[model samples]
Target: MKKIVSSLLIVSAFLLTACGSGNTNSSSASSATNSSTEKTSASSDANSGASEQEYTDPSQLKDSYDVIIVGAGGAGMAAAIQAKEAGANPVIFEKMPIAGGNTLKSSGGMNASETKFQKEQGIEDSNDTFFEDTLKGGQETNDRDLLRYFVDHSADAIDWLDNMGITLNNISYSGGASVKRIHRPADGSAVGGYLVDGLIRNVHEREIPLFVNADVTKINETDDKISGVTVSINGEEKEINAKAVVVTTGGFGSNEEMITKYRPDLKGYVSTTSEGSTGDGIKMIEALGGQTVAMDQIQVHPTVVQKDGMLISETVRGEGAILVNQQGKRFFNELETRDKVSAAETELPEHYAYLIFDDALAKRAKQVDFYKEQGVVEEGATIEELAKKIDVPEETLKATLDTWNKAVADKKDEEFGRETAMDYDLTEGPFYAIQIAPGIHHTMGGVKINTETQVINKEDKTIPGLYAAGEVTGGLHGNNRIGGNAVADIIIFGRQAGNQSAGFVKQ
Candidate 1:
């Protein structure tokens, strides 16, 4: 996603703040910095005469290779690692100038079940329960086998990342999960930043050559089985051959044209994904005899400010915030999943609402401060003043708060039915408000892949010598994707794609 460029003053601060906050800046630029350094060092360590030919002149890539992987986001990186571990020297090609895909811009943490992290906190979570929650969250439209694979293997994926050096500690109750399972990095940085950096570091240690700026344009194949790919490097076209190709290129959320084609209802909505997420892998593979599923099931998340579509993290509501309409009254419960909240927001009179919280609630969730800094938040001294500032009737707003405060005092919400009850009173002065609307956040549709991570072709059969994972492949998530499950979808299947592709090559 493009940063909302401000004056020079904020740019300098954003440079340092990007990695820390999920609000502004993307980790796409950082990949080139460390990747180039590590690639240089990895090349130098190879045996002198037997060292793999450093890619340049298109002529050198004419020969065949063992395996080729596309995309360098979480799934792509995980695939590269697993492929290497399976004893096949794999070459990775990332389209962006730097390789971290939209995975670097994500704010929500990953989902896992029955991990030691959950046990330490004594949270009762099971893979079966997680599976049922996933099914219910998707409205039971998700592919049973694929959902089963993701649920059963999610804990192992978390352990895999931790063993590879990405440390996830904190757990939060994500909207769709039955119990707490969203795991954040222990350092409090954006999970995308930590996960990307950790995977890149591990790639370097294994001496895998991850070529950045290698924009894969087409899949070169013979008789429809996997072969190799054609990439544009520095405006020069080069074709490289491989026995297997893994397509981990992410979704097309940022592509306005695709959004219009698939879900025309989301045409006017802004997106929160990176520019490189244009569904390249899906398009390229579709051109090569692959089929897609769930193309119409796009997920739009509510509570993202309209200007640049930057997220106002769900913490605001989780901590203690109420969403009110122009009539100065609460509508849906704030803790509802993205799909439910977005639907309610879309049906509103203005197709938007305001999230209001007290000063104490702000103190607990400090990320709201970033929204304030971005000038997207409205502040007021009292409830009536806030109602006035947000164009809601003073008396109506006052009555809403009166009932809300009474509910808080009574420890029961008779209004919209917030089951968590109230954590803070609205009586505190210095109220904050954020005007938000539903926006295109994630694409729940892409290439179709089975439980084994094999890409299915147009004939409804698994494509030989080809595999896919991450947002590039769909069907794991049916109509709506739960918050933390995306990270789970990418890594769990990314590892599986790698392992499967390596196994194919070995056969």
Candidate 2:
């Protein structure tokens, strides 16, 4: 928590000093550094009733294209754009009703270092610092080479999006980050809708073919080369061929069975992702003999409404709110990375916690009223009432509040070691609280890939004509993914995959 506040302050000061003027493109080629012999074991052929289907209807086969991308999310859209820009006739097939899958559902914030925004703000952030924070956040179990590559190229990825007019302007501190690299558009909503909108608009402007409601069920491979895909489009099976296929279908956060298989401890926890993120592409590639890495390393966003499971963005805590366990005691620093915070909360009996704040913090975060509208916010004139409303012991809650208030008064969090409290206190009337728990947010594991974005098979070799990016591909975020890094990962790797695929087809 102290680390986050200090970094935010430093970064904010840097932004103010720099005045957002010196933007640098952070995109670069990833070093081909994965020497860990790909233990890419083939997955079971049977999964969720799709892999066993017959692919014999030659009439169902469509004409071949240069590149075929699955999923119309941020990564898929980026891949298609880059593929087209690289002179390939690329087509994107989306399972959703339209383009913009879970990417639309994101807060739309992306992490980058040495960006003009950081420089403009006078923040002393760099790719090196970003790399270090990521490695530590992922517990250093991550592929160091991949981590180095991601940080090295993130700034360029942001610039690439900016060139295409898909730009996010605002910056803030985020979970598992050491500095203020979370960039989003000035949209008061702060959802990834803007990023998705910008990319979708670009897709339309470029006249890229986007097929919605097309779910890829099988990846057709002849010998060692991935030839095409079989997708169920509008209830009819159709075969689409391309020299190269990129799977950007995201992770299986919403798949109950997959979640249970990976994390049985979180079966009852809610999911804060799209239903389309059922790891369709992961399954397709795995069935094609791709190796999955760190399959058990699931990510759970720290807080969400207990009932409907709506995500209350981390910006809430970044502003002024603080979390307390069911006993109304502050358990861990609310500003800890999502994994650590969630792990602390899971120690409680019901796997639940609460976020308490005054109306001031709520207004600053621009979410309390929205949460109130959702009927998830519980308010009170005093701490006792707030605790009672949430069904925790009032005295316990009051003492907890007392300790917190004392810490605030002393300008230190003795119990949890938090930094500045953002100068807001629970003493303000109309205080609010919400019951929350860690909910499955991202699957940090899937298909193994090389730095060039080629999907690696279980035999420690690239499956020719195959590529992937976004959450579906693993080896980027080893044990856990940072908040804004997901957006960066999708776009950066997506562009690389597209460009590489275009080169492959031309060859």
Q: Show where candidate 2 strays beyond 4 Å.
A: 1-62, 381-385, 391-411, 420-429
| CA lDDT scores, all candidates in order | 0.74, 0.72
Cα lDDT of candidate 2 equals 0.72
Model 2 lDDT tens row, 66-111: 8999888889989999999999988877665445556766752788
RMSD of 2: 13.3
Candidate 1 Cα misplacement greater than 4 A, ranges: 1-65, 187-189, 359-366, 381-385, 393-402, 405-411, 420-430
- Per lDDT, the best of the predicted structures is 1
Please write out the lDDT profile of model 1 over residues 435-486, one tens digit for every residue.
9887777889889888888888899998888899999888887888888888
Clashing residue pairs in candidate 1, if any?
1-274
Estimate the TM-score for candidate 2: 0.83
Residue range with the least summed lDDT across 10 consecutive positions in model 2: 10-19
